[model samples]
Target chain A: MSKYTLREAMAIHASRQIRNEDKVIVGTGMPLVAAIIAKNCHAKDAVMLMEAGPFDSNPLALPSCVADPRGFVGAPWVADPVQMMGMILQQGRIDLGFLGGAQVDKYGNLNSTCLGTYKNANVRLPGSGGASDIGAMAKRNLIIIAHEARRLVEKVDYLTTPGWMLHPYENGKRVKDRLVHRKELGLWGGPEAVVTTMGIMKFEEETKVMYVSEYYADLGVTLEMIKENTGFAIDTSKADQVIPPTEDELYILRNVADPENIFI
Target chain B: MVSESKNSTKKTKIKTLQEAISQIPDGATILFGGWTVTRKPMAAVFEIIRQGKKDLHLVSNPGGPESDLLIGAGLVGISETNFIGHEVLGIPYCFRRAFEKGGLEKTGYLHDDWTVQTGALRILAGAMGIPFIPTKSLKGTEIIDPEHDLLADLRGKSKKLPNKKVEFIQDPFWDEGELLLIPAIKPDYCIIHVPMVGEEGTVRIHGGLFMDFYGALAAKKTIVTTEQITSEDYLKKQPDLNSIPAEFISDIVEVPYGGHPTAVQGMYDLDFEFFNRMVDSTKKEDTYVQWLQEWIKDLPDHDAYLEKLGVKKIFSLRADPGLGYNPRLKRKS
Candidate 1:
């Protein structure tokens, strides 16, 4: 049996989605680790961008934060928030983006703003810094968050960032009472996939509703276990056991990317 | 020396923290430059807290400790911008407490949120001396929903804020597509911390410019705090390095380690221990008060603040000459 933690598995699995030479915007935490590991492994040409201004940062080691001075070390060009956000991201130059939030709905709608209401909240989270823009503009995005019934809700408390949203899925038709698609809002894309502790979930191409695409059977995470942890009704027909983290990927994660276990 | 002689007639804007911050009136809209952890003007923020400046409207693209300190001290009444938490540090404890707890009740706090790109575009519009900017961001999201406009009643009533959060309309030129016309932000004061500033008020930023350049240009006036102060002649020797002109600055304060706990790229790295201390100290209302007393109230000046942290702790965070960050520093726990 291969030995690996769940977080390492999640990060390694998430890194596989990134393709070579794609420009990606990443924040802190697992997203950061995933991007670094992707660059250190197969996607060597993947460009990493940060809101704090590094366009393409290839760091010596995993920098502590996005604004870690290592971000500036190997960057080709540094930009302000306006240039990075407006000139690049909003203009749709970014290929992929990463987001994490307090709540992620079945449609991948994220709420990083607040819990109860805008005026008052049960739990007040950090409002959208760039999650909305990234969600709205990135051609494809990945969501990294802990898995729990409460977190994977049927409906988010606040729609801080847009995802593939639909209240009902009847007769394979998407448009009904009130329907909103990324294309309808002039947005290019929604979440491509959500990588969780259980496995990975991908949205249906037509309906844009999330489905369990893969599960970590080795970690004792079955379709029933994944479904039990989900708050919304989901389709498990397409679910399959995920590819386990390879020794090479795990080595790159431990030695090349995050040697100190900062993010892992 | 022709450039120096011609600029000599211009006023020198150097001032103490008190001198610069005291001039700021209550209830003025303010913007602090920096994204998350880099180049935050903590010195001015401390002085603002010490002076008990209240009713200020704080705006930043992605705020960190500078914004949190003000919010924690109950200084800001209205916060409009993209965010207010450290990117890696999870979230700002005080910003979280201010909303969940009754901390902001006294200030009648109001918060209106926007996305990152749109928010930065608003500031860019301000810098461009425009009234509004149109973008395709936040179209179907709740951000443009009329019901969520917290600044609804205060729209057009305030001098600084816009009449609405964002005006959604069909693209006038195309007339078929839709876009959002977000308002510009013109703050009364723009506070920034940079590594270098000339005695004659020429600003030079070595690393990422971040949002400081736009923030300075958009505000009515700017207060710059620097780690090193050089002569105009020295900085002018390398002209391409300079960003804002001398005329743009209203005041410049020389504070060597102005952005401690956070970071100022070329000079130092993030003091994670200190950051965790700030986060942990602000976990509870009582602990936060004690933290205020220990860090801000007890210390009268920047030197005292640095002394409290000690030279060892400060020096340990110094950036490696080549890497621009301390290579030996331990971040992972």
Candidate 2:
């Protein structure tokens, strides 16, 4: 196992979420690093798609931005956003999606809009770019964000992106025996994992509530720390130590994927 | 299909940037081409603001400085966009200020996955001379729910928005899947910046075509500003590079460094320092006004704007043709 920065470990963990030949929809920056690492390591043929409208892009270098020219370097088909999102993603062709959010809730709801109410905002973050669509439409979503109490809240200030929904009965049961997927609300599956700097979170099968599934042993994290840092109650029964990234995985990320450490 | 094989003769006339933009009047709806922080026709945007055009409805897949500057200047009456934020720099301060101050009106839904694609489909429908097109994007989302008045109703009622936001119905063919019918959007004028344009008005867009071709075709008229203007014969040799044929375009203007602060592929990198400075100043209304005075009002035209940018700074932003990014920005990590 390779010793790595928290960010690098997060990237590795996020990469592990992807599977071989998965039709992955990706956001920018860290997701880009993770996807590239996945392609280099195990999921070699994972079809990388960007919301900016490129498919099967074999970029010469890590794209500086979502709209970066590197995306078109060896891309097979360059399409419009309509073709990318409407015809492909909204058509339910995507297998996995990688996203980032400012704040996420126990129900996996995401907030990238204003911090306060819509009419009055203390701090207005950038609203959803393509997160709402990816979250609402992709088969499964994997969220990567810095772990902090402020970010992992009990309930997001605004539900910019829907996750596991609040069906009335689920709230009463304290466990979602009647847990509804986003598809029940006529959307796609909600988030499956929340990869953080400290650990990886997965939704409980029955309740659809998030809990720490894997803790970073190298970070010296404890179940108490995860609980204290989280705004809501968390399930630690299924939690276990996550295996660190292999040296080869670390080398590919550092030397090939991101030599500048721009995202790593 | 017939339009593609016509005479192949250039029909649109070339004009100065001023003369070309002078055609746009107040209350006109304009669609812009380019995505966030890349290939935006900032030169045309600055000119529109400098000309003091008002109440103009603007449309883009999702624009950056071009939309934010116009909204901040209080020139745009309504803007239909997917998302408007400085990509890595966070939300644009001016855009937020415009909405917070009630200076600009906004329509359309959030997220590029729907908004840009829907906007492009609207453009495509217009290009095909259709009234509306059916789409599968907005079935589950609230934007098409009709209950969401902001997105569904639009600003009161006007000829500008003649059709409903979306009409949900069962797919008649299969009688199973649900679909939404969206109305077409034909802007009065469309403005875009390209890497190069032949003398005959064939636009060669380097990098990604973020619905620029659709935006150009979907509008009543299109004005192109390019980094370089080459001969028709030069473009004829390589027909694949010609994304926008001359027939759809109305006017072509050669404006070097037309997409400043943003970027033009193979020409320059994004002026991060300049955008950062603008963001810092535009954090508050007072300083934002000051920034406008220095960057917009004080400058006579795009030429003066370039002059204000200085030769050294412009040169520093220039990217090597081979590398696609400025070599000056080397970070040893």
Best by DockQ: 1
Native A-B contacts reproduced, model 1: 0.70
Provide per-model DockQ scores: 0.52, 0.34
Best by lDDT: 1
- Which candidate has the highest TM-score of all? 1
Per-residue lDDT of model 2, residues B88-197, tens digit only: 65568866765443322342111211355566677788878898987654433333433223433443467787455666666889765556677888899989999889
Query: What lDDT score goes with residue B99 in model 1?
Result: 74
lDDT of each: 0.83, 0.77
Model 1 residue runs over 4 Å out of place are A166-177, B1-7, B101-107
Q: Write the per-residue lDDT of candidate 1 for residues B1-333, one digit (tens) a residue.
A: 344474558777899888999999999889888777777888888889888898889888777887777888888888997788876665688788777655445447788888778878988999999999998778657776666777888998987789877766777676757677889988899999888999878899878777788889999999999998888889899899898787788899999889887778778988888888788887877898899989998889778998899989999999887888888888754
Task: Name the lDDT value of residue B39 in candidate 1.
Answer: 77
Model 2, docking class: acceptable
Model 2, position B332, has a per-residue lDDT of 27
Candidate 2 DockQ vs. native: 0.34
